[model samples]
Target: MAGSVNQQQAVIYCRVSGAKQVREGDGLASQETRCREYAKYKGYCVLDVFTDDMTGKAASRPGMQSMLGYLHMNASKGSEIVVIIDDISRLARGLTAHLELRQSLAGAGGKLESPSIEFGEDSDSVLVENLLASVAQHQREKNGEQTSNRMKGRMMNGYSVFCAPVGYRYEKTAGHGKLLVRDEPAASIIRKAMEGFASGRFETMAEVKRYLESQPAFPNIDGSIRQQVVTDLFSRVLYAGYIEHEPWGITRRKGHHEALVSLETFERIQARKAERNLAPARTDINADFPLRGAVACADCDAPMTSCWSKSATGKRYPYFWCQTKTCGMYRKSIRAEKIDAAFAEVMHALSPAKGLVGLVKTMLHDAWGQRLAQANTIKETTKRDIAQLDKQLDGLLDRVVESDNPTVLW
Candidate 1:
C-alpha cells in the first residue's frame, strides 16, 4: 500500500547472521538491493538505509537500536513515516522478539513493510506473521544445534577444540586443515623445562618458572611468567600428544600434532610435584639473586640479599648486602663482580684432576662393597627372627590343641 508519493518517507533496515558472513559474502548488500527496488516500485521516498551484522534472534543490535531511536524522534510528526525491510525474518527470528517488535513499531507510529509479504490491517494478516516468525525461530535453533555438534566432532578427532598452548600455534595445513604446530624457541624452552623437572634439574614449579624467565624468547606476562601459567603448562596433555576435555565428554585421545616431552617424562614430573595439601607451603624468595638462600653473610651468619644502589650520577650499581640491621656489618655493600669472580675461582679449585678422580672412584667402589657386605649380614639376622617367630607360633598351636582352659583355646 503506497501512501501519497509526496507525503511519505521510508527507512530501509537490513541484517545478517554474523560479521563473517558480511565480510566473506554480500548478504547485506543483496538484501539492500531487493528492498530498494521494492521501495522504488511503491513510490516511497527513501530517507536512510541502516544495516546490522548480527543474529536475527537477537532483539538488541547496534543498528536496530539506532533505528528505533530515530523512529521515536519522528513519532510526533504529522507526516506519514514507514520502515521497510527485505523480509520479516530479517527483523527477528524468535516469536517473543516478533510480538514485542510489532508493539514497539506501533508505539513509534511507524508502519512495517516488506517486498515478499504484504502488510494488512486485519486479523488474517497478524496470524500469518506469527506463523512465519515461529518458522524462523525453529530454523535459528536448529542451526545452533548443528554448530555445537560440529565442534564436539572435531574435538573427538584428536584436534584441540580450545585455544592452543604456549609452545604450539594453530595453522591451516595444506591437506589437514587447521592443526597445531610447534612454535619456535618457546617450544624448545618448554621442552627443556619439562625435562628438567623430570630429571630433578628443576626441583619445584618455582624453579621451572625461573628457567622460563631466564630465556629471553619465552613469552611472559607482566615481566614474568605467572605461577598459574607454569602450573597449567605442566598439567596439559598436549605436550604428551593427547587431548582430554570434560565439557564435551571427551577423554584421552592421541593428538595429531607432535609431542615435546615423552609420556614417561610427563609421569615423572607429576610424581615429583609437591603434595601441596599436606605440607607447609614454601615461602617465595626474591628470584633476582639465585644465591640468596645459598650464600651466608660472613659477619652475621645470616643469608644476604641482592639489590641495586643509585649513585650521584643516577646510575644503578648491583651489590649484595646483608638485610640484618643489628649485625656489625649490616648494609655493607659488596660488589657483585667481586663476589662472582670469587665464586668462579672457588669452583675452579674444586674441579678434580684426572689422577685424583681415579683415586676417588676406587674409594667409592670399596665403600659400596662394604655396604653390600653389611646388607647381607642384616638379611641373615632378619631370616633368623622370622624362623623364631614361626617356632613360637607352632608351640602356641600345640598348647591350644592339648589344653582345656577356655582362655588358651579362645
Candidate 2:
C-alpha cells in the first residue's frame, strides 16, 4: 500500500485573484512552489501545474476543469490522482463549491490535499472541512456587505461610485474619484446632433442617423456605429447637464462634467422628438429593399434611397433616386426592374470557366497548406518573444530599484 501511494500521479492547482496579486511576490508562483514541495514530501509524481488568475467564488474555472478531465481520463488505468492546493480558500471562496468539489473528487476515487487542510473519504474529516468552509464563506459575505455599504455612503456624499461616462473622464485627486471634462472629436458630433434636432433639420431618428453618419467627428468603437448607441445618445439626460439614477428614479445635483449642450437646446430637441412621434406615419412603399444604405448616388455621393409611387390608374412603379438636392445631374429615377436586370447580367458575367475554376481550386489548396506552416512558425516565435519580454521586464525593474538617484527610484 505504501509503494502504491508513492507511485500515484498528482497535479498542482494554484490561483490568484488579480494580476496585481501575482506581482506582489507572494501569490500564484509561491503557491505552485509550496504545492510542488508538498507533493515531493508525499512521494507522488507531479504530472502537471494548473494556474488560474480568477476569483474562486465558483469552480467553473478553465484550469480546474482541465485538471479534473485529466484525472477522469487516467482513473480507469489504475492510476491514482491527487489535487494539491496551497489552501482551502484557494480552491473556493464559498462552502457550496467546496462541498460539491469534495464529493466530485471522492466519486472519482481521487483526493484533495491542501497545505492548511486535508480532506479524505472519512466522515469525520469531511464534516470538519465543511464546517471550516462554512465559516470562511460567512466571513466573505460579511466583508462584501460592509464594502458595498461604504461605497453607497460615498456615492450619497456626491462622490462618483463608477467610472465617468464615454464623453467624460475620471480625474483622481488625492486618490478620490472625480469627474473631468475631456473635449473629444465625438463631442462636436454630439453637439451637432442636438442642434440639428433643435432647429428641425432632422425630422426623425432615421434622419438623425443619416446626419451623424455624414459627420467626420462621429464616435465609433470598432469601425461600426450601432443603432442602439445612437438611440442611447439621443435619449440620455446626462448630456443635457442632469444626472439621474434611473433604477431608483432619483435625480442628483448637476454633474461636475461640462455640459455638451445647453438645457434649452436639449429641451427643444425633446420637443421635436415628441412632435415626430405624434405625427401620422407616411406610406413607405420601398421598405423591402435590402441594399437601401449600401448603394450610393453617382452624382452627389450621398446614399440613394428607394421609393415607390402609385399612379391614378392603379399601377405602382419602384425607382431609385439621388438624395442630394444640390447635385446638378438631371438623371430621372431609374426603374427597379432595369436595375435588377443589370445586377443579374453582372452575376452571369462572373460565372467561372471550367478550366479556370479547376486551376483556381488547385492554387487555393496549395496556398492554404503554406499558410498553415507559416502560422505554426509565427506562433512559436511569438511564444519565445513573450518569454523574453517577461524576463527583460523583471530585470529592468530590479536595475531601476538599485539606482542611486532618488528621482529615478521614485
Candidate 3:
C-alpha cells in the first residue's frame, strides 16, 4: 500500500505573458525548474508540465482546463495528483477566478501547492494560504488598472490602442504609439473593390465578392470569401475621410490618419446599400414559367399554366396555354416544342441587330442611373420635410403655451 501511494506524481503548471517574456527573462523554463525542485522537496515525483502563455484572469485557458480534466480523470483511480504552480497568481489574477479554481481543485480531490505558500489540513495553514492568495489577487488588480489607464491615455492622444485592421499595417512611431496605412496586395485589392463599387461595375455585394474571389491577390481566409468581410469593407468609414471608432453610439472618435477614398464616395456607397435594402424583390421565371404566378399572357392578361398530354406514339408532351375561355386568344394549348423553337428563332434574329442591342444597353444603363438619382432626390426631400415638420411642431407648442390653452398644448 505504501509503495502504491509512493507512485503518485505531481504536475507542474507554468505560464508567461508573451513571446518577449519567454525570450528575455525567467519564463517557462525557470518556472518549471522551481516547480520541479519544490515537488522533489515535497517527496512527489513530477509527472508532467502544463504551460500557458496567456492571461490568467479567465479559467477557460487551454492548458489550465486540460490540467483540470487530467486531475479529474486520475482522481478516482487511486492516483493522487498535486498541481504545482510557481505561485497562486500564476494560476489566476482575479480573486473570483482564484477562489473558483481552488474550489474546483478541492472538489476534484486534488491539491494545489506553491513553493511560496504552504497548505495543510490544519485551519491555521489554510488561513495563511488564503491570505497570500488574496494579496496576489490585489496586486494583479492594481497592475491591470494601471495598464488600462495607460492604454486609455494613449488612445486619447490619437494613438491606436489595438491591432491594425486588415489591408493596413501598423508602424510604431517615436512620439505617436502606432501609425496605420494601406499594405501592398491587400491595399490594391481594396482600392479595386472601392472603384468597382463606385463605377457601377459591381452591382451588388455578392458581385463584389465574386470579383474578389477570382483575383489571385484577394485570396480568401480559410479557403472561402466570407460575406461579413465584404460587408465590413464596404461599410467601414475608416477607408473614407472620416473615422468612426464606435458605430451606433455617441462615443465615436475621428482617427488621425490619411483617407483612402473621398467622403462623397463613401456616402454614395452607403446610399447604394440603403437602396439595395429598399429594392423590390425579383422572382425566378425559368423554372415556373407556365404557372399562373409565373408568366402573364400578353393578350388576355391571364396567367399561362402548363398541362401534360399524350401523343399518338404514346409519348409524353407538355404545353402552356391561356386559362380564360371567354378571352379572345388562342384556345388550343401551345406546344412547348413549338414555343421553345420560336423563342430561339426570335433570340437569334435579335442577336444580329447591333444597333438595337446598343440602344437596349444604353436605355438600361440610363434607367438605372435615373433610378439612383431619383432615390437620392427623394431622400433629400424627405430630410427637408422632416426638418420642416419638427420646426412646425416646436412653433405650435410655443403658440399653445403663449395662448395658455391646456387642450391645445395636449
Candidate 4:
C-alpha cells in the first residue's frame, strides 16, 4: 500500500474569479503552493499545475478542461490520478457546476482531493460536500447582488457606472469616484456631427455617417461607421451632461461631467428625428444632374429624373424626363442643356430690383445697429453681475476665515 501510494501522480488546479485577484493578490500562487504542499504530504509525485482566472459559476474553464484531458491521457493502466485543489470553492462556486465537474473528473480517471476537505464515497461525506457547495453558491450570488446595488447607487448620484461612451472616458476624481470626462478629438468631432444634424447642416443621417467616416480619428469597422452607431450616438442623452438608464429605473438627471452639446441642441436633435422621415440623398445627384429633383415636368408638375442616354454611335446625351407614369409627358426626354439655360434665365429674372437692393441694405444696416446696442447693454449688465458675485464670494471667504464656529460654517 505504501509503495503504491508513492507511485501515485497528482495534478494541482487553482482558480481565481478575476484578473484583479491574480494581479492585486497572490491567489493562484497561494493555492498552488498549498496544493503542492498537500501533494508532498501525501507522498504523491506532482505532475503539473493548472490555473484559471475566471468565475467559478462557469462550467467551462480552459485550465480545468486541459487538466481533465491530461488526466485521461496520463492515467496508468489500473491507477487513478489525484486532482488536488486548495478548496472545493476553488473548483466551483455553483452547485450545478460543482456536480458537473465532479462527474467529469471521475470519468477522466481523476480522484478529487482538496486540503480543506477530504473526498469520500460514504453518504454522510457526500451530504457535507453538497452543503458546502450550496453555501459557496449562495456567497457568489450575494456578492453579485452587492456589487450591482453599489453600482446602481453610484449612478443615482449622477455618476456613470457603466462603460464611458465614445466621446468620453472615466477618470478617478477625489470627491466623486469615477466621472466621465471629454475624450479629445473624438469629442469635438461628435459634437460637430450632433450639432450639424440638429441645425439642418446635415440634412440626413447618411450625411452624418459620411462625416464620421471622413474623420480618421473616429473608430470604424471596415472603413465605415455603422448606421446603428450613429443612431445610438444621437439617441444618448449623456452628450448633454445627463445620466439615464431605463432598465435601472433611472430618470434623466444632470451629471457632473461637462456637456459636449447643450441641452437645447439635444432637444433639437430629438425634434428633428421625430419630425422628418429622412432618407439618404441619391448618389446620382451630382454636377451633371444638379437640377435632377429641382426641375419639374411641364405636364405633370412632378420632379424630373435625369439619365444619360447612349446613342448607337456610343456617345452619351444628358436628358431630364418625368418619372410619374400617369403624366401626359411621362418619360418624354428634354435636353439638359435647354433646362440649364432656362433655369439661368429664371434665376436672372428673380434677381432683386436695383432700388429694392439699396432699400434692403438700409434695412439690414438698421437691424445691425439695433443688435449692437442690445449687445452693449447685455455686456454692461453682465459686468455688473460679475462684480456683485465677486463681492459676495469675498464676503463668504472672510466669514469662513474669521469664524471658528463649525456650526455657523456649516
Q: Pick the TM-score winner.
A: 4
Q: Tell me each candidate's TM-score.
A: 0.59, 0.58, 0.59, 0.67
- On lDDT, the candidate that comes out on top is 4
Q: Candidate 1, which ten residues in sequence have the lowest lDDT sum? A: 275-284
TM-score (C-alpha) between model 3 and the true structure: 0.59
- Where does candidate 3 stray beyond 4 Å? 1-8, 17-26, 73-79, 121-124, 138-142, 247-254, 277-410
The sequence of per-residue lDDT tens digits that candidate 3 reaches over residues 154-238 is: 5555555666665677876676657776654566567767766664445467767767776654558655699888898888777
Candidate 1 per-residue lDDT over residues 90-184, each given as its tens digit = 99989998888878877776789999888787999988988889999999999889988987898899887677789898999886678989876
lDDT of 4 by residue, 296-350 (tens): 7788775566778899999999888776677899778899999999989998889
The Cα local distance difference test for each model comes to 0.79, 0.69, 0.70, 0.85
Tell me the lDDT of model 2 at 71. 73
How does model 4 score by TM-score? 0.67
Steric clash pairs (candidate 4) = none
- Flag the better candidate by lDDT, 3 or 4: 4
